[model samples]
Target chain A: MTEQPILEVKHLQHIYMKGTPLEHHALAGVSLKINKGECIAVIGHTGSGKSTLIQHVNGLMRPQAGDVVVDGMDLADPKIDIRLLRRKVGLVFQNPEDQIFEKIIGDDIAYGPFKMGLPIKEVRDRVKWAMELVGLSFEEMKDRATYALSGGQKRKVALAGVLALRPDILVLDEPTAGLDPRSRNELLERLKTLNKKENMTIIFVSHNMEEVAYMADRIYVLADGRNLVDGTPEEVFVEAEKLREHYIGTPDTVEILAQLKAKGFAVRQNAYQLEEAANEIIALL
Target chain B: MALPLIQVKNLSFEYAVNQTKIPVLHDISFEVKPGEYVVIIGHNGSGKSTLSKHLNGILTPVSGDVVVNGWNTKEWSSMREIRQKVGMVFQHPDNQIVATIVEDDVAFGLENLEIPPSEMKERIDFALASVGMNEFRNRPPHYLSGGQKQRVAIAGVLAMKPDCLVLDEATSMLDTHGRNEILKVVRKLNDEGMAIISVTHHMSEAAQASRVIVIEKGRIIMDGTPREIFQQEEELKRLHLDIPVASQMARKVQSHHHDFNGTLIHNDEIVKEVVRLSQREVPVI
Candidate 1:
């Protein structure tokens, strides 16, 4: 038997300020299915409904039409517990400052598990685990003032808070948007470890094609609140013309190969990794 | 030769926590000439944002000087003049936007200087036109896309008629399309003889800059052209930073075939070089 999807959305539709002059169709007939341990990326330009789609994953936004199911719980069911669903899917917003509240880092990260009524010892243990997972030392940084930390540290604290809940799935919206190259790479590596070692499903919304190419095993392209295409990074990026039509760009690796092909060089355009793209060009030479 | 537009000398900054002062920026010095496009890149908490704040008097140095157009930021009476000479745009567009309407938002800065209504109108028009947001002037900022909102923010700063623009991760919160929009405007402004100092972590953005400055642990560690800086790929990786993908790919190809000599940072340059190399009678390794 085929493995069941951990999260599934079918023909999802949403309209902002419905029936008013300022109403906007934010999502229209979008559909996607994600496996339990998969790392997926939803990429689109501004106003492309990527944010709206993720909001539905954790019950932040109910389906205006169509259906959403997370871990066998149907969102359309009136008796379904949103609180429980949120615990299963941790969603991190774009800005770390938006979610952080406690002055101390440890207390902030412990908030989620504490609210769940877990034992005090378990809460502390979970906070320690989450902090270490995000590369923050529990001993050194747990007492640090949240406001005094750098942008990267603040983001780590926010992520640790979400991870402390021990969610089955982690969703991040532009997780590396404002981070430096080092921090961005470190965060991506942590997420990969979560997916590989813990079997945690990862879903992220991003505008950075390079990040998407590096982290996503499966890719979904969105445009105008609709699912434009879905496939592996190489498959989606090879359709460069289609992505450009929607104001999306391919990763630099694929872009350079495509440019060489346009210049009459016999180079492969499907390479998404730097080493692979380099090999393709070297072969041509 | 044109006089320097801004100069920083022996700058040091510290943030006061409960009872202790924590230093965030070391003794730093740099000079930006007129019409120069300089990009400051570093890992998060490397004092890049802290340094950018000093340019416009947002943060006063503890033991150093920042002179803008011959006016010292340390002088209280010259603050207004210094601010008018150096306008800053921050990361988030929503936080920076004040007025409900786009045109009014652009005019807000002009009115602060108590400019006459006639001159205010002219300045607002010129500012909006410069960012290509004149058509959205009457619309609500909330209704605009992220890129459009950022353009509006830049217009607001432009209305002040600043000689230098300091962008502190201004494009960090924007999508790829939005980033491109902002870069296009910045490049055009620099072409028109306006000095720009952009602080960001995006190596691809740094590739477009005339000069690249790398900061680490609150100190300026490297300063040179993009080509000069990105060529030291090992050093950048050691600092937890990354060169642009195009540059990385070029180096990888160079490793396989020892003939590629030049340091190519941009996509087009790499693509052209690859095509030229493919035309040569070099054997693949």
Candidate 2:
């Protein structure tokens, strides 16, 4: 808490279709502080303001009210260099089609660095490095057709395209969605390595509690455009009863442990991961 | 025995672009019995979505045939009959809702079939109530959560009075809570004797169905009861699919203590196993 957080949002508020009959408050009084090299997950129902909040992190959508500061750059200030800020903080949308446009994989990845006016060698280096980082072979994938790749490969390409910019902070919206379990695990592992090796700040929005429990260093639960809870996975998941009030769901591990606790068993209710809960229950036996 | 609700015979599909035929599904075949809940799982690009499109006559097979409720999809005239018999719910709920109000959206499909005004009203109310969205009948589609929106989409399809429901990754775009909400509604409808065919990426969701079908490389690779299919964990992993978390945890726990002997799929099953072992004072280091 003492260090200047890498990303901070103060009382963020947003209203969609403002001043109209269909007007809706997408975000309301939401605040967050995320540190460098930490992987944070924002969990909420579909309309719980998760997307709206993350949209503000990279200044994709300006907040109607409130403030967002990324690495000392205030998003509320119109004078700030919005383009430069985007380079420092990359945002990957939920749909792969929305991100991948170029026919060739290499061209799509080089788009960001090319747009930055980086030298030819630097852009080529970044594209190669990103492809390798996401486990895609540069030589093979660079010239391959983007649409011909499988779903998992397309997602990897999308991720590599964002990583090509070498952003210090990366924000992804449902990065593992629509992927098989193996691909989901692979993507999570790649992100963990980036966070550990590059000291990258990761802020991802997800609805999968199991992934959040496994990946997030800190978790935030949003409800009705408000910050319902924010804590470590263990702290937030153990509050099963409270979470239900916000329509928040927990992973199967936590749900099982909570059920045992409610049934008067001498079980550890705070275990969030399956292995941790499994080990705890084994000890009880 | 009653005729299978749907039957696919050597179904094959390919995308024809500029005289190049790119195969998406390969000789896929299956049958869904009345009131049965079947879940199809596969890695992305495994052609599960393509298969779903064939069930409702959205896409015709290139070299095979699909019969839905005794209607051949190949016949252009039977397209309407096939579509009406097999109500399809897609991944994005936002795309399916055609009306501003929930009730109006539910009535849209019925109106297309030229149902009488009195019948349309009754169908709309019944469909909304079936999905537990009757209370939000007056609300705008934009105002509902992802899960609620999906339920409303289901209601829209339900009003068509389909005998079988085919969900093509319908819950993929939702959060855990939203996904569960959709699954619960689907299961309830199945219990009410509506044949349900769900295509999903979530391993846990597949574990709950009456049957699990695994598609790989555009073909049906495996199909059996959940226990039968999940027992082949190594094979599933080879296909880029993951076993349910509880199933994996059970294996991990069994590695330490051989007392837990069962194919655990649900969280409750693992909890019960641990509880049974604890009563017997199984040695724990």
Candidate 3:
């Protein structure tokens, strides 16, 4: 909607283990700009530098070449405060267990504000608010052991921990990876609220085609450490051959449409939903 | 003509958690014949992963019989042999891996058996190639994506020369592209007569398999070919599992059209079916 983007990654190149037998050029000259309040999904086959690229956004890793400019702050600048950056752009990793350190749910949620040197009252309020954000009840789960929570609940606690930090941009690496269906939907709904109500910029890394179709406003496909395609979900997924070549699978709806088209059927190639595709075909005949 | 690849009879497991023997699984029974690609579906806490673990002696049953290659699970001597017969790839490849180098990780399981070093390299090469990880044989695990790491995990097991491969939510953490890559590898392995038992929540993934088994609280609640299992649209939804988006569309269209006749699964199939239905003249009142 604007000329300047909320976040700009300019010619970002990342090389792990710079000069040794184990050296890896994980990313090579990747450049893209993400606007504020954007919900972008990053999809790629394993070892495609998706994780590497996202880590750079939060200053977790420094790019060997190029830089990530978030809110006009240069990621590669040595003088930049990584702690402040981490607070603004929260990154939740693949496993919930990795960051869940507190004994109880409430303490875990408050860990962020506590670390940020907030007053005790402020931390307490944030813990309650963050738990509510992820749909964890204060009366039921506040004192429960973090270890006792289900996989889905643990993921929520992790999310609550991030939310307490008041991040403007949330970068999640497989946030819904291990969740149940209800929990996944609930998390997505909460995330939609965060993106809309709180106006948090969301860059979610996922491989679930349906989730991507349902959630992402824009998508970036990666392969062999390169940005393969960048477009809206409808456009990026419509090119079946390109997706296949890049190891990205089309959404189930689109895949079905393509299969029908291949079998001497009259399904519109653009339909990315069963109902829409069915409607398109019905209208066609 | 030959022994079934794997069989489970009233298998149950309980572990002592805080002095209470919490039953993670109840009485569950299933069987996998050779060349069968079976997918077990369930929500979180439905015992899908626990069931997959029991298939390969990763977790021995406490109450029932698990027989692999005619070897009873209770027979202590069969533990190693059973594991050798049924290879496993876990949900998180990072935890499953035991080595740094890709080829070495592939060769890890074989090396565990004290296989002759001379032949180990060949098996490693073949296994790496099987999962398309051959080119990255010398790469470290940290440099790869979640899918590639999982593939290497699969190759490690492949090098062990197992006949049945049980993936316990293996693709749960993978993004769409990574999931597809793993699916292709699973299909390839199954086609080559490797009995595959994948425990997943993704119904779309189950659509690729020949048979789907839905487990609930440690019981085989639903079991049939993909077509048969998915046709039970209502039951799957009750279990909190999603029907393929195409099926949902079909159900929608079928409700309004009194004389619609089409058995469609993929969205494209819905498109084809709708096209056919639309072209039909209106029925006589």
Candidate 4:
């Protein structure tokens, strides 16, 4: 038997400011399925409904026409508990700084678990674990003023706050948007560890093709509030013309390989990773 | 040679946190020549943003000097003149956009300078056209995509007629399409004799620069042309930075093939090199 999906969206449709002159169709018949322990990436240009699709995952927004189911709980069911669904799926927005509120880092991270009314000890433990996972030292950084933290550290604190809830699925919108190369890499590594070691399901919306290629097990390309294509990075990136038509960018490695293939070098066009592309070219030589 | 457009001498900066002075920038010095495209890259907390802020006197240095267009930023009387000469675009497009309408936003800077209404109208028209936002001049900025909003932001800055444009991670929040849009506009401006100082984490963006500056731990560690800096791949990796994917692929091929000698920073260069070395009939794709 095929494994059941942890989260499923069927013909999801959403419209912003419906019934008004400024109404916009943000999502139109978008559908996707995510298995447990899978790392998925959603890529699209701005205004392509990528954000609207993820917002539906955690019951943040109810579908205007279709259905969303998370862990067998149908969001369309009026009896479904949204708080429970949110606890099972942590969502981090693009600018994590906007989510930070507490003056102290520890206080900010602990806010989530504390709000859940967990035992004091459990809250502390969760906060510590979350901080450690994000590479922030609980001992050294917990008491630091949130305002004083760098852009990267602030993002970590925001992430830790979400992780303190111990969500089985973590959904991020541009998790490394403003981070430097080092911080971006470190965050991707931590997310990978979460998926591999803890079997946590991961879903992220990003504009960075490199990050998507490196971290995603499956890639979904979105456009015009609908699913344009879905496949592995290699498969999706192979259709370079289609992606470029939708204003989607391929990874640099893939671009290099594609250019060489066009020039008739007999290089593999599917190699999206740097080392793999290099090796492909070297073999031809 | 043309005179330096901006000069930073012995630049040092610090922040006061709860009465404790925390240094964020060390003694740093650099000069930007007119019409140069300079990219400043660094890890988080490296004071790159702080340094950019000093360029326009957003943050006065604690123990150094920033002179732009022969006006010292330290002098209160030169603040207006210095700001008029150096325009800054920040990370968040939403944060920087002040007016509701695109054309009005572009006019904000001009009105502040008290330009004659006739000249202001002409400047606004030219600025919007320059960034390719002319069609949306009457549209509300909130409804635009991230890239479109950023173009509007650039248009707003361009209306001021600044000699130098300093972008503090301006494209970090944008998607690939949006980033390309901003880069294209900036490149054209540079070609037309405007100086650019872009602080970015995207190594691909750095590859297009005439010069690259690497900062680490609040200090300027490396300053040279893109080729000069990216050739030392190991050093960049050691500092938690990375070279462009094309450069990395070139190095990987060099390691195994040993004949790929030149430093290839761009994608086409790598493709051309691979085809040249393939020793096979090139097939047109």
Which of the numbered candidates is closest to the native, going by highest DockQ? 1
Identify the runs in model 3 with alpha carbons over 4 angstroms from their true place: A1-5, A18-27, A45-48, A62-67, A148-150, A222-229, A239-241, A260-268, B1-5, B99-104, B111-146, B256-263, B266-285
**Residue A273 lDDT (model 2):** 78
Ranking by DockQ: 1, 4, 2, 3
Which stretches in model 1 have alpha-carbon errors above 4 Å? B282-285
Tens digits of per-residue lDDT, candidate 2, A62-134, equal 8679889999999988888998899999999998656799999999999999999999999999999999988
Q: Look at candidate 3 and tell me the lDDT of residue B45.
A: 75
Clashes of each: 0, 0, 4, 0
DockQ of each: 0.83, 0.63, 0.45, 0.80
Residues B52-162, model 2: lDDT tens digits: 888888898998889988889989998888888899999899999999888888888887789999989998888988999988999999878888999999999888888
Evaluate model 4: give its lDDT.
0.91
Residue B135, model 3: lDDT of 89
Candidate 2 segments whose C-alpha is farther than 4 A from its true place: A15-25, A63-66, A147-153, B279-285
Candidate 1 lDDT over B125-174, as tens digits, reads 99999999998889999989888899999999999998999999999888
RMSD of each: 1.8, 2.6, 3.7, 2.3
Q: How does each model score on TM-score?
A: 0.97, 0.94, 0.86, 0.97
Candidate-wise lDDT, in order: 0.91, 0.88, 0.82, 0.91
Task: Summing lDDT over every window of 10 consecutive residues in candidate 2 chain A, give the lowest-scoring window.
Answer: A276-285
Q: What digit string (tens of lDDT, one per residue) describes model 4 on residues A212-251?
A: 9999999999999999999999899998889999999999
Q: Please write out the lDDT profile of model 4 over residues B1-285, one tens digit for every residue.
A: 899999999999999987999999999999999999999998888889999999999998899898898989989998988888899999888999999889999999888889999999999999999999999999999989889998998898899999999999999988888999999999999999999999999999999999999998889999999999999988998887899988888888898877885599999898788767765445659
- What local lDDT does model 3 show for residue B119? 91
